[model samples]
Target chain A: MLKRLAEVLRGMGHRIIDRIWRLGSGARFFLYTLIYSGESFRRIHLTIREIYFTGVMSLLIILVSAFFVGMVLALQGYNTLQKYGSSEAIGVLVALSLVRELGPVVTALLFAGRAGTAITAEIGLMKTTEQLSAMEMMAVSPIARVVAPRFWAGVVSMPLLAALFSMVGVLGGYLVAVPVIGVDNGAFWSQMQANVDFQADIVNGVIKSVVFGVACTMIALFEGFDAPPTAEGVSRATTRTVVNSSLAVLGLDFILTSFMIVT
Target chain B: MERTTMDLWVGIFAVAGAAALFGLALKVGNLTSSSVGDTYTVTAAFENIGGLKPRAPVKSAGVVVGRVDNIQFDSKTFEAKVTLKVDKRYPFPKDTFANIYTAGLLGEQYVGLEAGGDEQPLKDGDKISHTQDAVVLEKMISQFLYNKASESDDSKKAE
Candidate 1:
């Protein structure tokens, strides 16, 4: 019995040490990626190409989702506010909720599902196919030439996509509130304009999107780079990118929101 | 996509995004500074300031003319003292009534300036002698309940 207990204790200790080693190496990989990112600026064309893939391609999903989200917000908001005899405040409700919270959050989640998965899958495939090794053999750091552009692309795409989502959402709210619901258009818009502050709502949202962009992209690149050179590994990495990014976005949202409200 | 075509599309995307952001700021967020000119500060005193915070809108005739700059309680008077930042251009008369008003019935409290028919324009550091405090809903309810209880006691005695 003592022998068995000692064996179990040794296994647990080894597992803990292994986990720490993996975490340290992961941190090292992130720093290396950051150090080599300057090469991406020199290769501006590549970054732009990545942007087209990440931002422009993802625009459709972002737009559609935002529109639906906006309509729902207006519908739900009208139902609640109308009971208070203040249906006119629905515009404020829709705009504030979208611009301040939902727009950045939903856009990041969609970007993760769309562009983030593509990034992880593409990178993991490259690693699996020995393309990353081939580049290294040619004296090129794959982190600079490959990973950095994709990283920058995602970071740039997030805020732009979020902004577009908010603008489109406000439009959707208008469509439903004014035409379908037969609410006064002037009141819907004017109340929103009067209440929401540019610095407080819009700028802070942009900040949030940018932070989420960086975080999501980092997780995607890290998971992709670390995946094993196998089909199952690449698929797992893609799944991890989506799952991890969504959780990260939600977690960061709570922390950032508390800070934003205070400041 | 070709390099030039890619650049063009990216450019368009960026421009459109920026334009939308600008429009959001202007239309929905009121990002642009109010058309009001340089502003000056004034102060007001209230008995109770319910749910009023700094940067809350200060309005006149239903138009936002300024913002609440600061709020402090006077140790001597034990009343909430609020400082107002009013636009220099929209000068109010000396007799302008500075009153705490609630928006949307149960919404936030703001200072509403009702311009009194006085030709004399108020200046910086001047206090409007006329002021009204916020009406606390809880206090009103409690008072009503007290009155009802007293009336019931009076009826019991009569019986």
Candidate 2:
């Protein structure tokens, strides 16, 4: 049994190494494709469509969720601060935490799970049905026709969605503070405005969103293109796209934060 | 089939709108320092700084008049020297006192300045004479728990 366990461990290690190799090669290929492409305008157009669908459409949900998130944060923060006789700093805490970290990261993860999966499934289905092949035969570049638009869309939509999330979150916090937490509305907004810097929170939120957009688009596209031509394959690809894109968004957020902090 | 100019215009509008909104948000947030006015500085010394960091607000009578700019340790006194930037309009007397207070149970610290009624206005680089150290929540909770345990032990001994 011990010998069997050792063999399994060795096999797992090799499989992990092989997976890493494939991921590295895949990333290189993607970079090459992007750099070598002459038809970036076409991708930009597709990106607009993605922004409209992913960003504008998702605005209401993001706003609602952010509002509640802000409210909860304010309520919890107020309670804690009140104990220390410093309930007034609730605005600063909510604004900073929401804009700096939660706003863009949470919105991007939601987008990845929702729209990213849809893009992968749609493209995977097209590939399996040979629609992509037909487009190629008809003198349309599959990369230009399909991938460019989706990629651009992801890029454009993410920042806008994040902004919406931040705004809604602040408003939500306001609602909780004034009505439930018993903080005066004017005091709440004034404190928030005083404490929060537009450049640090808003700009950072948008920048993170843009990065998330690119990450989500790339992960979805990669999964779709590499999917095996089977029904189960398409389903698996969609699942992988969502999970991988969400993880990538979080990882990228950390890297971006480190860079932002240093520079 | 070719796409119409109208389609291109619509796409441009969408992107432009998103960018415009982002720009507006930046403006509203005042993230740009260009809008900020002249800053004035004051100094305070604390025995224990706790979690007091730079950018913590300096409040006078529950209204923020300035922010903590920097914190450094004085090796001779074993205390923290915190510098604050107050608005030009707000003046502090030379005998003012600064206290480090927690804003919540989570123990986010801020500087509270109690203005003195002394005849002379505090000039720049003047140090506030009286300072109170921060009272952290964790320390208070631990102390409470220790007392409770000791009291329980005493009751058992009495029994």
Candidate 3:
């Protein structure tokens, strides 16, 4: 019986390896399709819709959350700084923390949870329903039609959304510091302005957001395309997409920070 | 196909608009107040640097004139020694005083300098004679509250 169990386990391992190899090959095919395509107009349209949905549509929530985050940072920073009587540096601390780290990362994770899950589930459902197969049968490349649009959308939307998040967060910090925490508005903005450098923090944030967007879209599309042909499979794919995308965003953030240090 | 063409144009416009806005915001932020470019080096001796870090701004008269470049311990003095980059244009007189000041109620600490004297200018690598260490706010507040409560207790006993 033990010998039989060992044999089964070995078989399962072989199957898993074979499955991973197949998935890798499929990914390569998708990459080739993207590279060979000349459908610039189609890609642009897809990207625009993605920006509208992922950025414009999600603006309200991102702004609200950023505002609160900024305010809390300022309040907390102010409380601590008041001890040594250098309360004016609150702006610099808030701006640096938000622009350099928190703003882009938090916004990307939020986007992954919302748009990333939706795209995965939508694609998975279409696959299970035979819509994707029907498109292929009709000589339409699903790679260009489905995957390209979502990929471009994520790439286009991420930077815009991240910028908005940072702005709102700064404003939030300003409100908290000036009114609630009793720091002067001029002092707050002045300190922030004095410390923040556009090249180092802002540009770095935008670059990070773009990379995050690409990772999120790719993970979602991959999970959706590989879903099992069942109702349960679509649900599982959606769950996996969100989990994977969130983890990927965090992982990429660390890698990007390390890379930024070197560059 | 026609819709795709229009969308393409729209995407271009949107990207351009976002980029323009971001540029404008950055310009405005820079215009209102900007970092000091002049750099001078000053050293301070501290019993404890605490969590002080590099890239921390060094300010004079509530305006940043430089940054903390490095921190190390002096074996002979048994104190943490900090190296500062002050703007070269902002002349530090011979008797300038440096103190570690915290921002807001819970913010990061920075080195604050008070310019002193009408005599000789401080040269590069000159040590600031006086240094006030970081005063942690929470500890002070708690102490103040404790003292207030004890005073109230004394008054109640006398009554």
Candidate 4:
């Protein structure tokens, strides 16, 4: 029994050490990935291709989701503000909520599900099939040639995606509030214009999305690069990318909003 | 997708996104609307300002013509002094009545100018002497309750 206890303690200690080592390696990988991004400038076409895959492919879902969110916001806000005879402020409610919160968040979540998963699966496949090894044999840095362009692409595309989401959302809100809900056309717009500040709502939203883009892209690349060379590993990596990206987006949003609003 | 097609789509996406963003900034955010064109400044004083802030819209007959630039308190007169910046296109008469008006029942307060028929157009650095204070709902409710209580007490004594 004493010998068994010693073995179990030793196993636990080994597990802890392994976990710490993995974490340190992961940090090193992250630093190397960022450092190699400087080499991505000359390879703008590669970045564009990745942007097409990640951003363009994710656009439909983002637009649809944002539209519904805005519609719902306008509908619900109109109902609540109606009682107070201030239904005109529905524009304010919908626009502010979408620009500040829903636009970046929903876009990021959908991006994770669609583009992020694809990125992990593709990279994991490349690694699994020895494509990465082949590149390494040729003295081509995979981090610079493959990962950096994709990372920079994601970062570049995210703000544009978020902006499109918000603009489309505002349109959706307009449609529901102005025509369907019978909100005063002039009042709705005027109240919204009077209330929402460009610096406070729009700029802050862009900043939030930029931060989320970096975080989500980093998580995707990490999961892909860290996955073992197997089909099952790639599948698991894709799942992890989606899950981790979602959590990161939501968590980063909360922190960013706290800072943005307080300041 | 073909590389050229993808590139074209991306260019469109980026440009459209930028245009939409600019529109949002201009329309909803009201960035381009303020501090553009020509504007002149005038000052008004009131007994109570009531949650009014700088950058609040200054409306005339439901049309936004200017914005509140600043607010200061006068010690001797015991009044709130408000600086109004009016667009040059919208020149108000000398006898314009500036009143602090709330948009809705429980909405943001702004300065609503009731244009008076004076031949002379008000210029920069002019003082709007005729001003009205903001309505304090809490104070008004308390006064109303006090009035009702006193009325009930007087009626009881009479009986």
Candidate 5:
């Protein structure tokens, strides 16, 4: 019994130490990626191709989900606000909610599922197929060649996707509120315009999306880079990418919202 | 996909994204509406600020002419000092009365500038002497109740 307890304690300590070591390595990987990102700009076509793959391909899903989210926000907001006879304020509710919180967060979440998984899988497969090793053998850094463009593409795409989400979502809300629910069209647009300040609401949302972009893309790249060179390992790394990116986006959202709201 | 085709798609995506952001700024935000140009700062002191906040609109005759810049508390005089940034085109006189008014029932509070007929226009860092405190509901109710009580006491003494 004493020997078994000692072995359990030792195992727990090893796992904890391993986790800390991996975390440290992940940070180092992030720093290395940033340092090597110079090549991505120099070879602009690479980043553009990645943007075409990650951003352009992901636009359809982003717009569709955003529309639905906005419609739901309007329907729900109108139900509550009409009770107080302030249904005209529905535009403000939807716009503020989307621009401040939902646009960046939901876009980040969707981008993680749509583009992040693809990035992780592609990179992980390259590693599994020994392509990364071959490139390294041929004096080409995989971080610069494979990872940097994707990273920059993600960082660029995130804010645009978020902005598109907010804009489309507001239109969806307008559709539901004005035509379907008999709300005045003028009031809808005017209320939203009056209450949503450009600098405070729209600019802050862009900032949040940029931060989320960095976080989501970095996690995906790190997972792919760190995956064991095996089929099962690459698959597990893909799953971890989604899980880690989602959690990071949410946790960072709370922290970012706290910082944004105080100002 | 062909490189040129992919480039075209990316170009479209980029343009669409830019258009969406521009539309949001124009249609859903106060970017164009609240662009007061070349503002001059002025200050006013009030006994109570109520729910007045920074960036609240400063309207003259129901038209927004400026924005509230900052709010500070003066411990010496026990008044709230509010700084206003008014547009240069719509200048108020030195004797302009600054009154805190609510837009509508349950709406945000704003500063209303009722311009005084004076030849001298207010400049930056100038102070407005004529000011009205924001009406506190509780204070007004208490004052009304006190008046009623005093009136009944007088009636009883006369009887």
Candidate 6:
């Protein structure tokens, strides 16, 4: 019984040690990616191509989701705000929530599932097919040619996507509130403008999106790079990318929010 | 996809994203309205500034002419020192009354600058002395209750 208990403890210790070792390597990989990013910028075409894949391709889903989210927010906010005879304030509600929290967060979550997963799978597959090995053998740093461009693309795309989300979301709310719900159109726009500060709300949301972009892209890159060169491994890494990116976005959001609120 | 097509899509996406950000700033946020140009900083001290926060609008005759820039407690004087940044164009007189007022029934608190009949305009770093504290709802309610109670007591005594 004591030996069995000792074995359990040993297993736990092994996991903890392995996690720490992986974290250390991930940090090193991130550093390498950053160092190699100069090549991606110099090439410009590589990063632009990645942006087309990551940013332009993801626009449709982001816009659709943002619209629905806004409409839902208006529907729900009107329900509660009407109790206080302040249904006009629904504009403030939707804009504030979307700009301050939902826009960055939802965009990041969706980006992780969409672009992040694609990035992981693509990289993992490249590894599985010995493409990465071939590139290395050719004396080319794959980090510069492949990873850095994708990383920079993600970082650029996230804030823009988040901004688009917020803009579309406000329009969605306006649609539902004004025409559908019979709210005054002027009040909807004016109230939103009155309450939402550019520096405090919109700028902060952009900052959050930038941070999420860095975290999500790096997490996906690390997972793909670390995955074993196998079919099952690649699939697992893709799954892990989504899961870890989401958790990281949420956790970082809380920390960032705390810091922002104090400021 | 072709490189040209990809480039075109990315270009469109970048422009759209930038436009969205600009739309958000102009249409959905108070960026345009809140840009009071070339501000002159002035200070006001209040005995109580209930819920008066930084960036709260400073309106003159219901038109926002400035903003509250800072709020600090003066331990020595037991007053809240509020620093305001008013637009240079809309200068206030030295004897202007800075009264804290609520916008609506339950809206945010802001400072109302009631210009006074003074010859000299207030300059930067100047202090406005005639300031009114924010109206505390609890104090108002209690005062109303006390007045009602006293009136009832007077009626009973008369009876």
Judge candidate 4 at residue B154 and give its lDDT. 100
Residue-level lDDT of model 1, residues B1-159, one tens digit each, is: 578988998888888788878888988886554544689888998888888887778999888899888999999999888999998879999898999998878666789999999989899999877898888899999999999999999999999
| DockQ values per model | 0.56, 0.18, 0.11, 0.74, 0.57, 0.59
State the lDDT of candidate 6 residue by residue for B1-159, as single tens digits: 899999999999999999999999999998886665789999999999999988788999988798898999999999999999999889889999999998776777899999999999999999999999999999999999999999999999999
- Tell me the deviation in Å of residue B4 in model 3: 11
Per-model i-RMS: 2.0, 4.9, 5.2, 1.1, 1.8, 1.7
User: A148-169, model 5: which lDDT tens digit per residue?
Assistant: 9999999999999999999999
Candidate achieving the largest lDDT: 6
Model 1: CA > 4 A from native: A1-19, A182-186, A261-263, B33-35, B38-41, B60-66, B85-91, B146-159
Q: In terms of TM-score, how similar is model 6 to the real structure?
A: 0.85
Runs of candidate 3 exceeding 4 Å displacement: A1-19, A22-26, A40-43, B1-159
**Candidate 2 segments whose C-alpha is farther than 4 A from its true place:** A1-25, A36-38, A42-44, A72-97, A138-140, A186-208, A230-232, A247-263, B1-36, B44-51, B74-79, B93-108, B114-120, B125-159
CA shift of B36, model 2, Å: 4.6
Tens digits of lDDT, candidate 1, A1-263: 99999999999999999889877987887788788888778989989999999998898999999999999998999899889988888899999999999999999999999999999999999999999999999999999999999989999989999999999999999999999998888778867876898888999999999999998888888889999999999999999999999999999999999999998
The superposed Cα distance between candidate 6 and the true structure at residue A223, in angstroms, equals 1.5
Give the whole-model CA lDDT for all candidates, comma-separated: 0.90, 0.77, 0.78, 0.90, 0.92, 0.94
Candidate 5 docking quality: incorrect, acceptable, medium or high: medium
True lDDT of residue B78, candidate 5: 94
TM of chain B, each: 0.81, 0.71, 0.65, 0.84, 0.88, 0.91
For candidate 1, what is the DockQ-based docking class?
Answer: medium
For model 3, report DockQ. 0.11
Q: What are the candidates' C-alpha RMSDs?
A: 3.0, 6.5, 7.9, 2.2, 3.5, 3.5
Q: Please give the lDDT score at residue A57 for candidate 1.
A: 89
Measured by TM-score, the strongest candidate is: 4
